[model samples]
Structures are given as structure tokens and as C-alpha cells.
Target: MANPSLKACFDRKKFVVAPGIFDMISAKVADGMGFDCLYVTGFGTVASGLGLPDAGIATYTDMISRIGRFAQMSRTPVIADADTGYGGLLNVRHTVMGYEAAGVSGIQLEDQEVPKKCGHTPGRRVIPAEEMVLKIKVAAEARRDPNFLIVARTDARTGLGLEEAIRRGRMYGEAGADIVFIESPESEAEMVAIGKAITDKPLLANNVEGGRTPILSKARLEEIGYGIAIYPAVGFLAAAAALERAYSHLKTAGDSNGLPASESYGFGRICELMGFPEVWDFERRWAQPAAKE
Candidate 1:
């Protein structure tokens, strides 16, 4: 089970910091760090898994399969991005079933149209508020587990302005969403406004590095009255930098011996991380060598 259910975390009234984990490597590393929740970032996951941009190119099948694996491997509660619920009302129902059965504790459903763009990126448009409200209603009803969360994300901030985004956030909350995400609030004042307007449910703050929203500390966000803060870009960005440095060093130096990165997390440590000890123990117990004579 997702230890300390995400709903419980919200009910606790303390801030929750969920790191964005894109792949199993990051997943294993993040899950062990003891965060109350983990966010499956669509931008990083789609890029890593499919070598595609997160402009709604990946299908529901693509996202659910990857998210399912992460949720299974993780002992922590996972909140995955389910873009636009993959389609309309019927699709929303199916997505809820798939994500719930796949062990995701929460799903972030955005209000962008089909082929949705990333939240902080430009040229994003939202579906009518009325349309997204119904999607939220269907998603809320489709979830079998009552605690399975429905996070309604409004990308209206970039296009429609802050007031409209906050209005939509309030609407979604009233429509039974467990949390509200107002994407791309450019200023701290806008964030404070969002926090104040949407009071019924927990507010999710997207702390994307270099994104429109300023990166505030957990304490600042809690002070601003946000409930969940997802740092979705940190893992992928860090991984990209590390891989680039290592690859650049290897190509330049022609040897792994004198690399810039410390090699302490080498083969043995990685093997332990990948649970090789259990495999070796299984082999020892089941594959005892037979006597020659």
C-alpha cells in the first residue's frame, strides 16, 4: 500500500514536497529519500520513455504503463500526470480505472485541449471551464478507491490571466477535485491570490525549475497556504547534467579512470540498489550445485 496515503498527507495540514521522478533509476533514488509523495512528471517521463516532447504526443496507454511500473516499484505514494484525461468523458472513466488499478494514489488532470502543451511552456490554450468541470466530475465518479485523488490543473494562467485561472481553480474545487493546480503563475502575489481564493481543497504548487513560477522553499509555500509542492524538473535536469558531463569527459579523456564525477556510486552500489542480493540469494537456495559422483 502507499504508506501514509497522500490524502492523509493533505489531512495532516503540513506541507508535502513531492519530487518528480521520470524513470526507475530516479524512482529508486527518490523513493528511498522518504518524501511523503512522488510526482510522475509528464514532461520528463514522456521525454525519457518515448523520446518525445510532452505536447500530448504520448497516449494514455503510454503514460499508464510507465506510471504503473513506477508505482509498483515505489513504496511511496505516487501522483501521476494524466494529461487531459487522455480524451473525453469516456476516456476519463477508463483512465481513472487504469490508474487506480495500476496503484497510482493520485492523477493530475489538466484543462488543456487535446495535444496539450506543457504547463509552463508558451502557446497553451485551455478547454472551456464548463467542459473541464464535467471531466472533473466524471473523474471523481470513476475512481473506485475513494481516496484516489483527482488534481484539476488549469493552464489558463498563461493565456487567460491570473484572475481567470483562479476562477477556474475555484470552479474545479467546487466540482469535487481533491486538489487544484493553477499553472504558470508568474508572480508571488498571483500565487498568494490562488492560495487564498481556492480554500476548499489542497492547492498544488508546481515548482518547475526556471519556469514561470518562482521557486519558493517549502516553508514559503506552506506560508502561502499551498498544500502540495511538486519539484518535477529537478531529477531530469540533474540527470541530464550529470550524463552530459560524464559523456563529455569520456569522449575527451578516452578513459573512465580520471573522470570529473566521483565514482563512489559504482557497480556494487548500483547492484544493491537494483536488488541483486535477493537474486543472488534465490540462486543460492534453488541452484545448489549437484555432486559430480
Candidate 2:
């Protein structure tokens, strides 16, 4: 059965914290660790899958394939970052349908142009508010399932200003966006103002590490009236740091003896976590069945 829709989470009024996952292994790990939802981050996807930055370098096919893997491997609902819906109004429709068919519970579209950068990164630019509004409308109309969420994101905070960001967010919500995300609010006061200004729809907060926005706890975010908080780089950054340490230790010590056992997962444990046992069981049951006498 499908996991509960993100709309259910919103209806419950509970703050949903979706950890970002880029690949199959991370998706399985997050599901096993009991995360109710997973975010298919564009930044993590480009970094991990393509060995590139999130500067709109990943193509729509790249994102769809990556997000499809996550949705297939994870038991939790997946919310995908569909950056700028990959193009204009028609492109937004196609992106929405493709993601929904891939089993994504939600799709996030931004207001930036084709070569959109990461929300926290500098040199980001947004299209006109009316242009984004049309995209949002097309995205909302494209989903076959009403429960499939449309998250409209505005990168106008740093470019145009907080007030303009708020205005764009409100416009998006009015255009049928299930959620409005104002990217990179510089201060808590700005967050509060956004929360107050956009009250008609649920809001999503991007909790990017070392990014522009302040990292607030889930409790505090709920207090600030955010319905969803996504930690888009926690897993990727941690994995990168650990790999760096592991490589350095191997170069110096010539072995992994110095690595802490608690922090490391053994080969067999990793296989189990990835359901190798189930694969073997299926093989035994079907591939080489016992004699029926």
C-alpha cells in the first residue's frame, strides 16, 4: 500500500521533517530509520548521481530517473525537487505528470529560470511573478491524483527582497499551489513575517546546512507555523565528511582499524539492510525448489 499522502500530514497539523535522500541506499536507510517521508533533493542528486553541482546542470531525465529510484526503494512518501519544472508551462505539466507517475507524493517547482542555482547559492535569479504563477497553475492541473502535492517555491527573497518573495508566494498559493516555499529568509523575523503574510496554504522551509536560512529545530519551526521542514543536505554532507575521514585514515594507517565500529556498518549488515536476504529467499523458493515428494 502507498504511504500516507503529504496532505494527510498537513491535515493532521503535525510538522513533517523529510530528510533528503539522493540514491537508493539512502532512501532505504531513511525508511528503515523510520522517517515518514523522504525528500529527493536536486542538489544531492546532482552531486551524488552526476558528480556535478546543482547549478541547473542535471537534466529532467536525470532528476526523473533519480527520483524514480528513491520512490521505488523507499516505503515512505517521496517529495521531489522539480527545479523550475524543467521549463515553461508545458514543461511544468510534463514534469509534474512524470514525477507523479514515478510514485512521488509531491513535486516542488521553483520560480527561477532554466539555469537555476541552488536556493541558498548566490547568482540566483527568478522569472517574473506572473510567469511563475502560470507554471504553478499548470503544475497543479497536471497531477492525476489530487493528493499529489504541488509546492511552489520562490527564489525572490535574495533577488527582489523579502516583501517580493512574500508577494510571489501568496500569488503562487492563490494559483493552486498546495504549499508555498519562500527560499532563504535571512532572519527569523522574516520567517515570521512570511508565515503571517501567507496563511492560506501550508508552507515548506528548506533547512540547508551552511546555507542562508537559520537552522531551527522542528519544534521551533512548528512554532513559526511551517508545515514542512526539509534537511536537504544532512545525509549528503555527513556521507562526504565520513568518506573524507575514511580515505585519509586509509592513506595513513593502511587499514580501517581506526574507524569506530559504531559509526561503520559491516558488509553483512549492509546487505541485510538492502534486502539481500529477501532476494536469496526468493531464489530458493522459486529458482531451486525442493523435490515435491
Candidate 3:
């Protein structure tokens, strides 16, 4: 099946559920689960992969490289995060091209300042709307393909309020953004408010599990007019917590055999997800023949 791009998804009107992926394994699983897209989220990558928060510590190169890996490994197209475009408007142009070259179908650029903080975190600041609009313009211009989506994200829900956030969303749409992501809404009312305010524009919403906001179901999100809902922490959070528990049990028992048997995964199940049979087939086909034949 052909992978779905952000552009194609907007018109579908159904909320696109993109589970966040930090590694090739998660990418493979997301693809296997028939997810419409893969979201290479900055927060999930930093916390799950680097053991850090999404505090602008990771570089653009690092993010793109990780995104490239997922895009290569999975059939799902990636929706990548390009935080603050790594700098100014010119920097946004470069960052846009960079992520495109990395094979992302869509890229989200936030309005947070350099050394950006987490959108859900306290003390978050934002750049002027004009500055962000210029960045969005550069991003829209830099995209080589019209199918490549440029998502404008504002951290304004915390800094300015829902009104300004919706205003920014409209301004971003006017400035050439393909979709607007109003990050980190704290309640169902705010979620409905943002969606209602940006009526004509394609809207993106974050569904980070265990984060500061309430989690809404897909049907509810679609009713609220959200085009995409990214679960950036779902897979990463589950994996981290499970692994931590397994490790604790092993350390205390000195053996995994004593751990809960129901929690185990079979080798074949993992191998299939990793495409082990295909690899073995390819290996056998290409292996050099021994002495006689």
C-alpha cells in the first residue's frame, strides 16, 4: 500500500492518528499496526532515545538523522518536528529543505525562541507572530513538492491564550502554512475552541499520553475538526515504563525466568516484525556457493 502524506490526509477529514516513533523498531511496529503516518516528535526522541527533555538540546542534524532512519525503515511517511527551524527565517528555509531531503512528508515548525522549551512545560516563551509568519513563508517556499506539508505550531496556548493561539493559526494559514498545530491545549473546552476558531484551515493536535492535557478519543477530535492527532508519547512512555519494570524484576530476582511469564514476547513474533524471514531469504540467495555447488 502507498504511504499517506500529510496533504492527502487533510481532505480525508478523519483524524489521522500518528503514534510517535523514536527508533526503527517503533517505526516498524507503527507501520505494522496500519498507522497512517509516523510522527518523529522531538519530546519523545529526547526523552526515550537520549534520556532528556525537549528543551532545545537536540540539534537539527540529530533530529533529521533519526527521522531519516524511520523514513527508510517504515512504509509510513514521517511528520517530523523542526523546532524553531533551528534559528531565523533563512535558517527555516535551510531546515525545511533539510527535512525534505531526509524524506519527511511533513514538517512542523514552532514559534518558540532559540533554546526552545517544551510546549507543555511552564515558562515557555514565543516569538512575535510576524517573525513566525516569515518562517512559515520560507518553509512554504522551500518545499520542493506541493504534497510536502508545512505545519505551523504555536506555543501560544500557554504564553498568549486560546484566542491568540487561534489568531496565530489563522495568520500562519494566511502566510502559506499547509496546517496549523496549536500545541498543548489544557482542556476539552480549549481543544474545541481552537478547532472551532480555525474552521477553514487544517488543524493538528497533540495527544501526548501522561502529559499536561486531557486525551480525547479520535472520534471526538474529528468532531472538533482536528485533521491530525499525534500521540507523541504513547509508544515511548509504554516502552520505557515496561522496560523499567522488567529490569527491576530481573535485578531483584537475578533471572528473567522468575519474572511474570505472561509478560514475555516470543522470538518469532519479534523476528517477523524485524523482517527476519526476508533477510534470511535474501542471504541464502546471495551467499557464495561452497566448494562443489
**Candidate 2: TM-score?**
0.95
The deviation in Å at residue 3 for candidate 3 is: 5.5
Candidate 1 segments exceeding 4 Å error: 1-4, 261-264, 290-293
- Give the winner by lDDT: 1
CA deviation > 4 Å runs, candidate 2:
1-4, 286-293
Q: All models: lDDT?
A: 0.90, 0.87, 0.83
Give per-model TM-scores. Answer: 0.97, 0.95, 0.93
lDDT of 2: 0.87
Model 2, 175-270: lDDT tens digits are: 999899999998889998988888878889999889999988888888878999999899999988888888888899998887877667788999
List pairs with backbone clashes in candidate 2: none
- Residue pairs in clash, model 1: none
Q: Which candidate number has the best TM-score?
A: 1
lDDT for 62 in candidate 2 is 82
How much RMSD separates candidate 1 from the native structure? 1.4
